[model samples]
Target: MGRTTIGKSNAKIILIGEHSVVFGQPAIALPLPSVTTTVVMSQTTHGQTLSSRYFDGPIVQMGQNLAGVAALIQALLTRFDAQDTFFHIAITSDLPAERGMGSSAAVAVAITRAMYAYFQRPLTRDLLLATVDIAEKITHGNPSGLDAATASSDVPIWFVPHQETLQIPFTLQGYLVIADSGIKGQTGRAVAAVARRKTAFAQETNAQISRLGQLSTAARQALATPDLPQLGHILNDAQQQLAGLGVSSTELNHLTQVALTAGAFGAKLTGGGMGGCLIALCPDRVTTEHVKNSLLAAGATDTWTEAFNLEEEHQ
Candidate 1:
């Protein structure tokens, strides 16, 4: 028997900016420390095995849908010079998949970290980013690299494709209420849809994308100044732009409206947006509770709240 190794990664959510980010626009993402994915690895006489809610069997026997994870395991094995090693990799996650929560990236990060630890090798941030990116490609077809980067980071990130990622400092003076629509989001399909529309309505689409970029810039400033109202306004504008792009769905709109009616400072569909979850910004804990209850009444499948305190965060 060999030594056991464990690794963990936090989930992530895009605070603002999604499809537009692909076109070199900036976006913001926050790490969800409360939600996480963990991977445990140990030597086994048998060939590679995986145990998770979705699958339980030899890694080779996993369905094609798991090809992304399979490719990641193989890559790690080769990188560590342990191609012949047989290990049982067990995965557990609290984050829901297909909800724009960076589940796949979190899994890849956790597994990759576990493998490095198993080999007693030093794992650098650069290596971790590069390695997890390979798996992200398998899952997202063409990821913006935002998910992987944010999943591995602890603080909020400001990302511009092909440029350096910046960490944004701020104190969250309010609460974010995340409400699930209970529908799976098709990120690849959504990206392709946006591209097709861009071709059909080049000028209109490009203008909207540019507006989203502008909103992201304003959002960055609001975050720095810790202006909750200004941030909320920017979010509302971003959602309107996203809706114009045709990514917003009826369910998402309904939930967003409900949250707003319930006194949320701002509300918008997060992630790929065809279907997934929407986030509502509440000015305080009382408003957060009101919105959460209202979302439940409005048919939200699930809801969770994250509170932010800049003073505590700095400490």
Candidate 2:
């Protein structure tokens, strides 16, 4: 049989939701056009084994990520009755793991897509998303499923855990400067911290997360109306809530404030937060550059900006 190829899935940045999403709160997620992972499968002479290659450098393993991914693949193979199938799968991506980006989810989605194609099974977005969710559990223990959903679909989604999902309209189209801190934050550790805090202030924490979900819904309307100021306010509010969750670090807070002070419409830490990247909302390229420079000046180790065009679809 001929080699099977699948489309790549872009990495995601949780603009306004992270820890709160785990608590059944709503959050807005956007797909970045900058980084993506692809998987290609072909028959091999040897028995089943998965090989991976990163686009930038070596594939670094974190929190048993490699083993988890391998297990996911094995399960998929078993389900397809291709247990003994010999195939070679390669991956190339710019998304760095442990940087708060949806690196593992992207890998899972890409691999699942490739496997489905190889088996010549009817593929659906919903099925692929489900596979990614299971794969996520192996990495993060209890993921909110937002990462997998965003990575698999590439649409700007308003994710409310245990609630109906909404596709938010993009009103303010501009650039989003996403810069990494080069700091490694294990999702397991971050989740543990939140769990500890929950033990202390269970009701208060739950109430804050509930408010955050409501704010996220309001933010969606702001985005729909292209209200930059309102959107910025919502992001700032969400950041404060996440801070209460104990996910925001000193460095993350510093980065966010710097971006905001430098004219970024909105700024906050994305992902698990303890240490990762901060996203800055800008109205245009000029504002984005201004914020990017400010981020570097404010002790940001690495900073970059990406334009958010509504017409441009991420795959």
**Among these predicted structures, which one has the highest lDDT?**
1
Model 1 gets an lDDT of 0.88
Please, what are the lDDT tens digits per residue for candidate 2 over residues 1-315? 657677488888887767777777778888876677888777777755455653321223322547567777778878898777776777777788778778889888889888887888887877887888777888777777878878776458788778856556585677788877667765567878888878898998887778878887887788778788878888888888888888888888988998888888888888877888888888766788788888888778776565666564421
Choose the strongest candidate by TM-score.
Answer: 1
What TM-score would each prediction reach against the true structure?
A: 0.93, 0.85
Q: lDDT values of the candidates?
A: 0.88, 0.77
**Ten residues in a row with the worst lDDT in model 2?**
54-63
Candidate 1's clash total is 1
Candidate 1: regions farther than 4 A off: 310-315
Location of the lowest summed lDDT over 10 successive residues in candidate 1: 306-315
**Candidate 1 lDDT tens digits, 1-315:** 578999999888898889999898999998887678999999998688999989999898988778899999998888778889989999999889899999999999999999999999999988998999888898778777788888898889999988968777877687888889989887778888899999999999999999999998998889879899989999999999999999999989899999999998899989998999999999877788899999998888988777776333310
Tell me the lDDT of model 1 at 73: 93
